[model samples]
Target: MADLVDSFTPSDPSDKSPFTFLNRLPTKRLDAKITRAAESGIPQQGAQTGGYTPSYLYLSHVPLFPLYSDRQHELLAKEDKHKQLMIKAMNDADPDKKLTGGQKAFLGTIGHLVGAGSIVSTQRWERRLVGSNVMSADSRMKQDKLLIFTRWTVPAPPGRQRQGPLWFVDVLEQRYDESSTSSLKSLSGNATMLKVGVADGRKVTLQLLKTEAKGIKTQKMWSKGTKTDTCEAMTFVGDNEIVAMEIVARIERTASMVEAMEVRKRFDKEWLVPMVQ
Candidate 1:
């Protein structure tokens, strides 16, 4: 596996396809034994599922910094200041009544859960990776970029179905081998960095990598030397399938198309979203 990843980095950037190389990385399947070994490492015990099916692999594209710029915040604050008197008036008139637009706007600024987004929100989103199993890592990965060992013990609660997979991620910063550079370039090129909020209303930047093949689109983003409490660093790969369901509309062909479309959308929302998220 290591040899494959190491060799995957193309000698000539234009000569090889990075996505093809990445797609070819070995896919490891989990049986009862592998699951048990992974589960045993978890601090929290859970009912053992002897085996877990490999789900599809995906990359999450997150912003490198907060969504709101300093100028935006400054302007919003100034605008909110103008509404202070009105907000106070609304609060005093009906303390128990529904919140007004100004009140909501003020609250949005004060609260981290606003639609504008925040650092705390990003952190919470990142931690979602915890308790999820990582099937494999890119071969080009190493101490310089990221190093993920095949032998791992991920922590999980006993039978927490809501938890996607268990992961114990590690961070590293080292120089990549010559071959690895090509892979890195492929992942890094043209992909923009995003501004994502961190904890306590802070923000950071992240790089994006997006690739699609065989009807699967993998969008990835990365941050350097950043680690969460339980969630570490790892790329998760799983299995995804397209199920063909028959929907027959006896009266109208259009109705059948609509029904089929609805079913497909629902299928993607339910099965596909969970696998990637």
Candidate 2:
């Protein structure tokens, strides 16, 4: 017993023994190279491009979210039934009773996960360019003119088809003189006129009117102080007369002119600017 105890006894701190290998190991230094290498493992960011561009330049590459299809809906229903069964199992005390908070949260998270994995077709707006004839007419106009065509889907009015939403295509053109420095000076002078204001509802109303009219185009100065205040020619196509009238009526019924202007701004930014490159 004495010999066994001696063989198993711990060595002195200064003594070299089989276990001393651990003590001899060097502490790792915090090398900047190692830190940098670890940091390189993180994602590298690329340059970010923001703001609007012509639709013709990048519309085809835009990603679209697809609506749920009938088959997907059916599968979702089945999944829901399965979830209900599992929830009942989790709370066997009363199968028909409402789920407890914990069970509901668990099931809701699972539903989202399953839904994410399901397959569905995607959709994006169609886009093109118009007024090519004018662009080709003169080199000077070519430098100043930009025309973009794009369409966005809106919920169909009641009693319309459910397969897809209604699509409204808008043609927007931007024109400015590049050769003249005075043009830039004028823009700088009227900079405050470019401020966005809610009282600018008439501008959209007038633009809508020009869109409804045939063979007539209107150009306005930027002194209007609205985002849509910029000088441009616009036209709306592929809108059903009845639906267009209904939509216009809805806008006209907005609580106040300010609300209407806000709605207009929101729609342009969300639906129009996204088409820009």
Candidate 3:
């Protein structure tokens, strides 16, 4: 089966057409597995199923999310901002369809959540924006470069072919044997994103300015000589290329739902028990 899968190269790594390793799937059991994996966000977890959700949801499921201090902090800040806005909007609205213009602006995104077009709210909008993307020296002192991990551990979509939670990672600089443009075009999907941006010799560091808590937890210094934390100096790649983009579809969780309900239940039990007594 592995050989059979190996023989068929997906147009991209994610095509998953009916003819691919997918076809070998004995529909019912395979579907159950996929569904289970989707909800559990892992096959062994629980009553999880697979389908389309946002990239962030997928990020949440990963056992470990490794990011630089600044990047992780930025992402958290972004999520908080969006949550606040959502809370405000949900509270102020009439609950009926009679929406004011401001409410109308938010309808698209809300609708998307309930199965419409891929909508993003303004509060969380920049998270989707193609901001600074780059590729730098693995390390100047002790160089180590391998561009192969472009394929992230992000998951595949569940049922609907129409939904997309795509990603855009840009290549900032031109590196030897790397073409940012082609790489960007190659990784076209709804599950993951990669874009590239060029750095003009200025020392680049993604720093977290707002919060005191450093977001970057795990850092791999690919080279031996450098600081024990950072990977080797990032290499310049592409022709000043801001390249690569992936939008890997995410499978939202069953356990998270369970966790939420459990929390609410426990809270309610606590409150009700006190009141009854």
Considering every candidate listed, which one attains the maximal TM-score?
Answer: 2
What are the per-residue Cα lDDT tens digits for candidate 1 across 134-222? 11111111112211111112223357553443221111112222343333433332211111112222222211112111212322222
Q: What lDDT, from 0 to 1, does candidate 2 have?
A: 0.26
Highest lDDT, which number?
2
Q: Write the per-residue lDDT of candidate 3 for residues 1-277, one digit (tens) a residue.
A: 5432212223344535334434344434433332332222111112323332355453433322111123323433443454444334433332222445665555544543452212212222222121111010101101111111121221233564522333212211111222222233233221111221222222222211221111111121111111122211222223343222242222222221223223223322321100000
The whole-model lDDT of each prediction reads 0.25, 0.26, 0.26
Q: Residues 120-206, candidate 2, lDDT per residue (tens digit)?
A: 100000000111111121112112222222222233457866433222223232223234332332442111111111222223222
Question: Which sections of candidate 1 miss by over 4 Å?
Answer: 1-156, 163-175, 178-222, 225-277
- Kindly provide the TM-score of model 3 when superposed on the true structure, using C-alpha atoms: 0.16
Best-to-worst TM-score order = 2, 3, 1
Give the least accurate 10-residue stretch of model 3, judged by summed lDDT.
132-141
lDDT pick, better of 1 and 3: 3
The C-alpha TM-scores of every prediction are: 0.13, 0.19, 0.16
Per-model clash counts, in order, read 33, 0, 59
